[model samples]
Target: MGDPTAEANRGLAVGPFAHDGVWLRCALHCHTTQSDGMLSPAMLRRYYSMGHFDVLAITDHDQLTPAPDAHSEDDDLLLLPGTEISLRSPESGGPLHVLGLGVNAMPRVPERATLLETAAAVQAEGGLAFVAHPWWTGLRSDELGDLAGVTGIEVYNAGCEVEQGRGDSAQYWDTLLSQGLPMLAIATDDHHYPGFDAFQGWTMVRAATRTPEAVLAALAAGHAYSSNGPDIHGIWIEADRIRVASSPAVAISLLGAPPRGVRVNAGPHGLKQPGDVPRGADGRRNGAYPGNLLTEATFPLLTGSPYLRVEVLDAHGRKAWSNPIWLPARG
Candidate 1:
């Protein structure tokens, strides 16, 4: 089988996204027909190019994605194949969807297939399979433990986080980090419309170009930074140590620091912060924690903590995300 990280990195030679070590940006998950999305792959490709997105995956429901091999590339845009295998719960047989990116063909995961069986097929394909939107689906994201060779978890889903423009999904991953797993956190739009751009949370990956391979490589090797807006240019990590930066000339602040501290600095996106992961009153962070305006703070790196990452949000609170920057195992 091919290495997903190596495949993802090879495409770096393709564009300006490759110019001078800048990270390429992309949306890893989204839908189209091959399943139930309002926008066709062609329409999505048009919008992605105009919006300056480097790449995207069309992970349709219960079907494999080649995303309409029909859309013409207008220059810097790329469409990758993916599929959201709709695994059903054994208890009530409800949906337990898993996303498979960068696969060459579909491996069968019957609708009634257990999550573990489905994940096996996905891993077998040499693709990265993530448990998507578990909080929304009434399942815990951590349930992937029953399976082997799983990668990534949607800690936040912007579409599910409709309240104050932040997704509750990150909490699930944060909880996992507290226990020390290299659970790659991400923000997804799960978008279905041009109108639903609000769901478009993503990661700025250190990749050669915006391709399925680049995104996966950035994701696997822990080289990605997340964002709703205000790009996360690069990150600094050392053991329990952590430092985050964004596009130059921006302010940075860390939010929710009591046992935790929020710090800010200048460089990429111009800021950084650290905070004790907050638990909501009902024990759910339905709001943007660690505060918004990622480019506004001065902070220190905690060299003993077992985990760390930064949340990047735009000033409007419209788009944002958290990417895992440090994990005890991976760091």
Candidate 2:
């Protein structure tokens, strides 16, 4: 087998997520009474456990509220320490939040903080840091390029969606990929209220075991995908070909910056006009544009490209996204 680290860095881990280990449904970001959330740690545990989440990280604002020890004593659930940090960003003229997951202890944050400072502190404490909802934070995509030491970002923040409808940050991930950044993206509930924002988003990680270390290691290794509802069962990548298997998706897209992306659609619609896509109860287009439902797709990538990632949009307007796989630039 090739080097696992190298394959992970390329964002194309083959068969590992399916055959190498089991898939762990994880709520990697959420909140509780340790900060502004309505639920206490114990209640949060009960909620997610009932939701069928195998792993949880209670990322309260500016504070680390580890799950109750009793919660982890059972074999069904694993809890990891986490917190969210806020820092001022001049670009957005607002605060940017970063989620520090798998933390051993809370980072030392100043009364006033910057993104780089806070991220460094978190990493120094042996945590994995992810920029939390750049769109929700009023940040432009370029603003994130200045920050370092972050593993990835919250591509979809469910709380931001329910509250202000500013959640889906898929464009930001594409922007970073176009800039040649090897960043990963995840979907999260970022739940504050108990039932309102719960279970709307989650990360699906592939690990050898259900322990915190394995989950965190999978996250750090990009052996994961994020979704609102759709599930990606497998991704197969070769030198110039790619194949994806997922829940009944309306469209499977291989996306990069403009001029670098393509998609395939399934159903009797036969590629409807962009305007013909049906609207959902939310008034947004259901599934992806020009398609109705699909469960698998394959695409070809020319050699010596920049980067590409996979996105699957289900009939219910939910989506699953894989971390981007970088390619060598054309000579």
**Clash pairs for candidate 2:** 249-294
The number of the candidate with the highest lDDT is 2
lDDT value for model 2: 0.77
TM per candidate comes to 0.72, 0.85
Candidate 2, residues 1-331: lDDT per residue as tens digits?
1222233433354534534777888998888888898988888888888888989999988887766755544547789899988777757668788899988899998776766778788888889989998888888776654567879999999999999998899887777767777788889999988779999999988888878999988998888889999887666675566666677777778776656666766665334543332221001123654444665566676344477788888878888898877666744
Backbone clashes for every candidate come to 30, 1
lDDT of 2 at 199: 96
Residue 227 lDDT, candidate 1, scale 0-100: 63
lDDT of 1 at 151: 74
Candidate 2 — worst ten consecutive residues by lDDT sum? 276-285
Q: How many pairs of residues in model 1 come into backbone collision?
A: 30
